[model samples]
Target chain A: MHLTSVLVIGATVIALLVLAVYVIAVRTPEGKLDHVGGMRLVLWLGAIFPTVVLTALLLWALPAMRPLPHQSGDLRIQVQGEQFWWRLRYEDGNGPGVISANEVRVPVGRTVVFDVTATDVVHSFWIPGLGGKMDMIPGRINRLVVKADKPGIFRGVCAEFCGLSHALMAFDVIAMEPSAFDAWLASARGVPARADGRGAELFSANGCGACHTVKGTPHTAMIGPDLTRLGERRSLAAGTLPPTLESTAAFIRNASRFKPGARMPAYSAMPIEDATEIARWLRSADGEAGR
Target chain B: MNRDPLKWHERLRVSLWTLIVPPAVWAGHFLFSYLWASISCAKVGSFARFPTLFVAGTVVALAIILVSGWIAWKQQRMTGDPPPHESGTQIDRLRFIAKSTLLLAGLSFVAVLFSALPVAFLSDCR
Candidate 1:
């Protein structure tokens, strides 16, 4: 058994026995026994003893926790919790780093320290398969170090109850072998492929460039998510919808239909054919440039 | 400290030191240490601040507990002791209450110390 379990169970049993004795002794004939001496014994054994033991335990635990305030890891991932989605940035030691939204790709067998903060309300960042959750509070950064023992897809979510769309706020984390992760990162940094010029024109004509971004294109804005690799993402609308042509178009037309309180305004006024072409064009470049 | 005659019981009587001081000290330590550590961390961004605050809190809390314990001892000396047979009488009541409070204070002192222990072990404010 773990030392903590043994100590806790042992203490509980001893306390229960002491309580039984105290109850039984108190019920005895009044003045039949010396009160001061027995009460002193109770105070000594039941009160003082436990206090001393707990103090010792706490002393041990204190040192164990001391390293947290100072320790850090090699790989850093800055994750900012926004209104309902996550903004992920992978920083390569002292580098400007690459930015993505709603998804993170990390390498297996390496410690990735998360610099967690919030752009708006307080939220919690949790990758249950990786480790414990850390709060993402506005104006404050919390560091949480996590490592994946093996390659796998891990789901991350906002654990805090922040808003109406809190439960719907989620992300996907893909953990790859070291070399594969490196290769993916290399490709992820390249310019997005420009395939359908007509669709791109339609996207720009509707003012989509004001919020979303497509790398290597004229559509560059910081308000919403970067859509350079939108087609490649596993989910849309912050994990509210699967990455399908129809789903992407639906999300683009009206994100609130899938995720209530989504920040992106609906494009329902745009022509249906234009919206479909744009969604198709965007998703068609998902794995472009072999990213 | 004694302002109102009607609120006499709330006054810091040497007689009731064991009853009041330990819990008061414990609560004070908990609140003050947390507040101090938070403010210090926000301003300093230093890793060493929390442990220092907690260590100081433990020392101060222990001092308060010891003082209360001393008062209990003195009260015991004057009142003789908790009676072996007597259930009523001012001396008996005072002794009983004093002993009870001393025990509670001792336990509370340990609890207050325990509350500060986690900051010593934890590595981050996050």
Candidate 2:
């Protein structure tokens, strides 16, 4: 069983014991004890008994509170919380930092240190199943070191209230095997092969390059999230919708409809075909596409 | 009126100030623990591995509370009229205050120990 389950069960038993003691004390015969006798009873049961029990409990819980040990060679991932998205940068002692958005991937059974911070307002990075929440304050970096023992996809969200779309801000945490994760990270470092096509033309025509970045292309602006591996991301619009072709097109045309206060302006004037092409181009740059 | 069992100097020595000593030590320990943790995290990026200073502070607080409790225990055990202390004699009042201070000391001893528990467990700011 989980440590939390054991703690809850223990607490329930203690509470029930206390309740039983209270009931017994209240139901005891009145006038049976003198004032001195009553004072002795209170001193023993009320003061000494509780102090002893609490000290034992404190000792039992102290070991669990110890922080997990980490080393300098651990994989460091810097996660910067924006208004309604997560900007992720992976640094595995590799050449350059690999930037992604709205999704976090880690190697199972390995220490992953998240250097969490914020760009605008304060946010909190919380992956409830993995570790405790860490506040992401502007100009201050807070480190949240975690290790995923099992390989699976978990959902993480912004635990702190930041803006109108705070509830909509979420991310996917994918824990992969060490080999697969290493391969993915290595491939992510290389440029996508399919940066030119009809969809690419449409994406450039719409001036998306001025804000967003696509690796290996001249659109290297950092105003928005890097779409280098958007196609492989599990979710779109920060876990608001599935990363389907239609949803991507819809979001591209009218992002504000799904997430209020999003910085991406709605391209309501753009034709459906043009929006679809842009979305397609964005999704085609996965590492697999290059291979 | 019953003869004042406690002289004026003795009464002054066991004033309300004595009653508050235990809890005041507990409060000081609590504040000092948190401040120590905050400063350690800010300067060292984590709590010190040894934390000798924090341990010393806690030992001093616990020692003060223990001493206070011992004094109160001695005063409570002094010969006085038993049971219903309704006579409000000087001895009765002194014993009552002593008993109250003893209980407070017991409570504060545990409080200080509990406040220091976190230091023993958590080694980092997290």
Candidate 3:
């Protein structure tokens, strides 16, 4: 602890001892000691001392609580919260930048500015192991600054009670090395490869194109997550499913089975085989299928 | 609602208002200043012209605190008056309440001032 905290704690302890000695050890009604200093102690030490201590602590914490400057290596990303999802825009430092959903990427050892906001109900963006939560109020953008020292996939949850699927809404924070992050960004710009060509055709034909977007494809919609890099994600439906072919297929077929009250309509009528193919296609889209 | 005209409480409502006003002003100022600074600063990603908001808010809050303090001082001034109707203890209780409220006013004044200190050093609310 710092010297101020130590002094505060020490003063508090000494004050407690003095109070105990005065209140419990000394008899007040029987007049064991003088009463003149008693009122002075109560007024000065009891009341004013605490106020001074708290004020000092607040003063001490003020500087540390102030937001840090966005360093040269800082990454800027805008996170917009919806009822049950997060829309992300990574400031690629070039052009309008890379649009994404659910998953966020940042280089380890670099500060990240999450310019958080929401479209519908209020939501909060929180990465518990990383930093504090910032509210994403509708019509108001709140920024949360954080830094990660190690490269890992940290799970983030919506700390606000936004809607029915609030418990299911989540995202993944993938902190990678700067070189690896640049490579990932570069790959995200290109077309996603699919294990099955039929799945791409099915994805468009089923009207799923109206909500989701896959870059280099005709179907560009703003309602759903950008599927350009969906295959490269760690989880789907806001971390409700593992990034696997079976989970993808299952979620596409009947998302309500995994997460009841999910916003996506159930596609139970889709043929089991077609669902499996589409799931494989999405799984491949994660960019791991080629490896 | 069941207030009796003969009781000291009926006469003491003014003093109670005096006790309550400073903290209420403090709460309003605290919330407004933080939100105004946060929202305005957030929109532009900078603290440009934010010091004005801070200054205006702190000044308003300090003025309110001062006015309430003066009211509490008036209530305490009335503590010297002798009880009129077989009620010396009632006067003493009034004095006690007034003294306590004055002390609270002092503490809350300090709190209001302490809260404003952040606006001076912290340029942004991000």
Which candidate wins on TM-score? 2
TM-scores of chain A across candidates: 0.75, 0.86, 0.77
Task: Show the colliding residue pairs in model 1.
Answer: A62-B120, A62-B121, A65-B121, A65-B122, A66-B121, A68-B123, A68-B124, A69-B123, A69-B124, A232-A286
Off by over 4 Å in 1: A1-73, A93-96, A128-133, A137-142, A192-194, A270-274, A287-291, B1-17, B39-44, B49-57, B70-88, B123-126
Residue pairs in clash, model 3 = A231-A285, A231-A286, A232-A286
Task: Write the candidate numbers in order of decreasing DockQ.
Answer: 2, 1, 3
Looking at candidate 1, what is the lDDT of residue B27? 85
- Which regions of candidate 2 are displaced past 4 Å? A22-28, A32-45, A193-197, A286-291, B1-15, B40-46, B76-97, B124-126
Worst 10 residues of 2 chain A by lDDT: A282-291
**Candidate 1: clashing residue pairs, number:** 10
Any idea what lDDT model 2 has?
0.87
Rank list by lDDT: 2, 3, 1
Per-residue lDDT of A125 in model 1: 95
Distance (Å) between predicted and true CA of A136, model 2? 2.1
Please give the DockQ score of every candidate, comma-separated. Answer: 0.50, 0.66, 0.37
Q: For candidate 2, lDDT tens digit of each residue in A20-58?
A: 978987998988777878888878878787788778878
Q: What pairs collide in candidate 2?
A: none
Docking class of 3: acceptable
Q: Which stretches of candidate 3 lie over 4 Å from their true place?
A: A1-46, A71-74, A128-132, A137-145, A197-207, A216-219, A286-291, B1-94
